[model samples]
Target: MHRRIIAPGALAAASLLLAIPASAASYSPGAPGIGDPYYPYYGNGGYDVSHYDLRLKYQPTTDELRGTATILARTTQDLSSFDLDFLLDVSEVRVNGIRAAFAHSGQHELVVTPRTPLAKGTPLSVVVRYHGVPSAKTAYGFTTWHRTPDGAVAADEPEAAWWWFPSNDHPSDKATYDVSVAVPDGMQAISNGTLQSTSSRLGWTRYNWRQNKPQATYLATLALGRFDITTSTSEGGVPVVNAYSKNLGDNDGAARASVERTGEIVDWLSGYFGPYPFGSAGGYVPDTTTGYALETQTRVYYSPKQFANGSNTSVVVHELAHQWYGDDVSLKGWKDIWLNEGFARYAQWLWSEHEGEGTTQELADYVYASHPADDAFWTVKPGDPGPDNQFDIAVYDRGALAIQALRNEIGDKAFFTILKGWPEKHAYGNASVADFRRYAEQVSGKPLSALFDTWLFHTSKPAAPAARTASLAAASTTVAQPKSWRTIEATNDVHGH
Candidate 1:
């Protein structure tokens, strides 16, 4: 990664320009929260992080992970003190390459005050050194920094960034990452981005990976364990990598096949969702864990359930689709998560149709019927599913239902246009539910407010017009059936957490 050197004169000039009416150089503590209704303390304010250079050394024998996170950020306001959401042990802190006063509070807040006040628009670097045993603490369910049978991996979503390293820890604070992990002699360490280099010395091995694109902290991942690793590239020279636990002695063939199919799925999704959004693509299906698969940027992490049944291949496709919707055009707030899970879940439906299983309408009808009209599933609308119910089936299943409903209402041309163009419009940035409604209306050239109201925000289930859904399924471009595809549509069981 290239280091950015900011000149004093340049920053000073910019700071003066930004401070149109400078009165006094007064500074106060940065806000403890970024004002999300669901998780208030998730992200901090006062500075915008641009890059994270995280160097971590893990000892599986002791379960003790040591880390030093150097965060590069631009000051959004003149600050006396700021906070980073870090949860583990901390020994020292530095601001602008020098030691600074620091304090820890609550469960994950690390407050730091520099010797000198920072001016607005000034670029700064804060290096934090810490060491401790890392543990996964899913505020919602099974989330980030999981402890697998052989080793550990990170898969934080929504609000678990403090489990491994500290950061703004929200989708809105997306930043580029340079993560390097060192493990013991026998164990392998994996993370996002293209592998830059590896070195071994004194019973320790290091693997360095760099993700040059901006990524949310929660989508960041690090898996360290016994993995049967493979390396290759796909269409257009995009690197394809796959690593799963070698411990699955008998099921290795199935697991390997699923990983190898990543290239095929990428090609399939690109045909619909535009070109892949990252420099590399792959997955980590660690054996011996009852966890869920996560779309951790380029590489996803799968649960042991994916190996038990051949049906988990579709789970891989869903997570990969998120590389476009969930990871690329991320949510502006937690309420808009339907933008992530809805599209990914619908992608599974599209795959089901393409491969000669149930058409998307059938899948939608089955999922909607599987949940009774009065069941607890439809109680919380996906557009505003409260924090506790955010991951509920309402988000995944009914969210897909809403998307399919819009697809049928708008016809294939406008629907596919929004699917390919929406993400491209807000590429590498945050989007809200309102943004999607307007886009659907504009592209389709129709009033979609009532459709959005009924399907997304209404408490009651929306009517599924069978004729409309069938028309879409019939008109869609589907290929011949692969003998391997299951006749029954794969259950929406293993969700993308």
Candidate 2:
């Protein structure tokens, strides 16, 4: 996620002044920035990407990856020039099968000028060829595209897809993918969707993966290494593909057990969150130095640290829940990340309550009481947490608390509607906090402006859900009683770290 400056004269070099065909004169250069508040230059404009065909080859000995990205998109406006988020060294570029002039400009922006004016709604094809070592970068204190011991991982919370391929990297521009990676013989490669085919030829093995469902670029990932692979089917008939590195050694057993519980957990979550959103449901464990686990679309990339210390079921549930909250229903911008992390943390509480290990009420109360009245975590609002605090504990912990507060205020039935209906309503699309507020009010039949303001937007920590729920229930006596209840417990353990 490094902001790249356009190399000296890279964009305006005389060599790139190719003539534009005169058939269509109504065209202008598309704007480079997508206008996101936190990440103004994250995605490109004037085009909608529909599909990507990526062919990659990896050489462990050289620590290098060479690849080609073929993007299929449609123009949103008449455009003579467009941009893709691309880093690394690229050799050739083509637009609609014709050689085109392109350059690296403005920190990861690959500006391409086609020789003709592309009409609005016309299908366009862009191809780029690149080669480099994909190494993790520390941008704004977050690591992305981290190289692991055995293989490498391409993952980031909001935006890092630019590191791997030329793309419309922002979350709002979702696209399906067909990714095929070739590695040395005897090793394995895993990616987003079902494994369509695997073949070997002349000491190289290629794993072809297809993720047909619309996916945000960040959710697209690739992991390669010697792995113990497992495949199963959920009771609901969704395929499950789980893998773990042999490097885990003694911890592999715990990782395998977690995989076994994955199918059952997906079914359990389906009971509450409606059908599983993706075609596949599972996770993969990588021997990565990185500390965190990420819900990478169909497969959550579990770090070695997760199973080595302990495999907390709540943590698993937290990431699995993100497949719905974050992956299926994406964020309109980085500012609205609570729509992703908050709902995942809330799912941890929901899972704990259903399993009788702990109650969501207790979890919420525990998190609310962890900080002093003036703690920084409590002071920052989940919806508007500045860029530095985007992934802070406040975003996850306090976000869950705010959502639990909403559940308490709206009662069980309507809250369930918000949970089940939110994902389905915005299935495979991006949504914002204002969008969520309008949706909640529509489903719950309650004027929730004050509630949303206090819990999600206000700077100060609000009253506990218990006090808020009691007041709400007393105010509206016609509301039905919550289907379940649990007395708050005194435990100090936070549900999901």
Candidate 3:
């Protein structure tokens, strides 16, 4: 009888109640990839990692690595399952202190299904126990783990974290790190940030390194070997630690001469790019056959080959400048790599000028004239260079040329203002080429769309400015072609990612 007199409002309420279960079932699996065009599966989706605490032990004899990684993150969406970018074998995985179902989706993706669905905006803790020979592992046709004679070093651009630890694994999702590595006694384990302490026990030694500032996963590094470690302080009390492999042989003196100036170069960089962005500043010269250097956060990774031709502080300047442009303010995607390489290269020109080597204008003119209009170098657009050309020399040289052009277009005042202001605006964050263009426009009060297109996006060489030609002529006549210009050219020949 009461049902016969049911009101329309009560019917609506009953209908709403019936829809609750369906609404509760709205949760879905997070995406497997972060959707970068260059490297589709480079990073994971649905979560943003905040911190990573990795406790690792390595035995060089067996070339085996064992580790436990504790990742602190927050879900960005309702997640029934999520993925982490990892390549090693996983022994166990725990989500929120509970064992979760997991499987390897691909070479780099470790898919995890939590026992309970996770709501968006909730904090998550994941503990993963893993053991593998990172040197033996390969993904996407290469390995970031470089096996050394005494020990191993994990240092590579945009992909090293996947080898040493499970992570979100992209510049867009930066997090602080606490890397504690335990190796055999008499050996050293070097990593990013400040070295907290070292303890010895049971024929094993553990080194604790902490990075307080937000850093891209790729910037987290690990070097385990015999190193001659030196410590100092920079201009602003930033602790400096330089490591040189004891067996660097002929390259030993040169490596030391170059990286030992970490404190001075960092202080010099602070003058142009604002204060040093990290609490620690230094670099490690490891004896690896890979003839490349990487800007691994506060502590850069320098191969012995970097100093094969005398002390190369120009490379040092390039990497340290990355501390401001690439490290402090990272790329939103792999495509914006010019934002990292170009500015770093430009810093080398500034250093050359400061050292009476070569003016920025001279170097820019040399690079512009060296690469003819029909050269293949012009075809690789720096702003959106594909994965293959991501680290190409053009991205660095032309990228710097773009900067010189910007300076010419906007004058020294506006250009320098942008150089100092861009990092401050996007400190400890990720930005895109478009973001830089907009920021430049905002700072200079000029539209930079056409300028960016000509210098960054065009598939041909940008035209030399009339003023640049005149300036180059004057520089040629008045300047004696600074010795640093030749150094810049030589360094660029071997500049590696």
Worst 10 residues of 2 by lDDT: 485-494
Give one digit per residue, the lDDT tens place, for model 1 in 90-198.
Answer: 8999999889877765556777778777888889899999988766333223335667767887765665568789799879989999988889888899988889999
User: CA lDDT of 407 in candidate 2?
Assistant: 85
- TM-score of predicted structure 2: 0.89
For model 1, state the Cα shift of residue 109 in Å. 0.7
Best by TM-score: 3
Residue ranges of candidate 2 with Cα displaced over 4 Å: 1-26, 136-143, 463-497
Collision count of model 3: 0
Instruction: Count residue pairs with overlapping backbones in model 1.
Output: 0
Candidate 2, pairs of clashing residues:
3-107, 4-106, 4-107, 5-107, 6-106
Kindly list the per-residue Cα lDDT of model 3 for residues 366-479, writing each as its tens digit.
777767678999999999888778878899888998899889888899999999999999999999999999989998998888888988999986654642532433222333
Candidate 2 lDDT over 1-497, as tens digits, reads: 22222233433342235355576557766667676777666787889999999999988766688999999999999988888877768999999999887877755678888866788898989999999876632333444677767777777656667767889988899999999999999889899998999999999999999998999898898888888898999888889999988788777787677666888888888878889988998888877765567888998877766666555566677788888898899999888989988888777778777977567776665566556557777778888787766777788877887788888888999999889999999999999999999999999999988877887777775654544562322222233222221211111122222
Q: How high is each candidate's TM-score?
A: 0.88, 0.89, 0.92
The local distance difference test score of model 1 is 0.77
Q: Is candidate 1 or candidate 3 better by TM-score?
A: 3
The per-candidate count of clashes, in order, stands at 0, 5, 0
* Residue ranges of candidate 3 with Cα displaced over 4 Å: 1-24, 464-482, 493-497
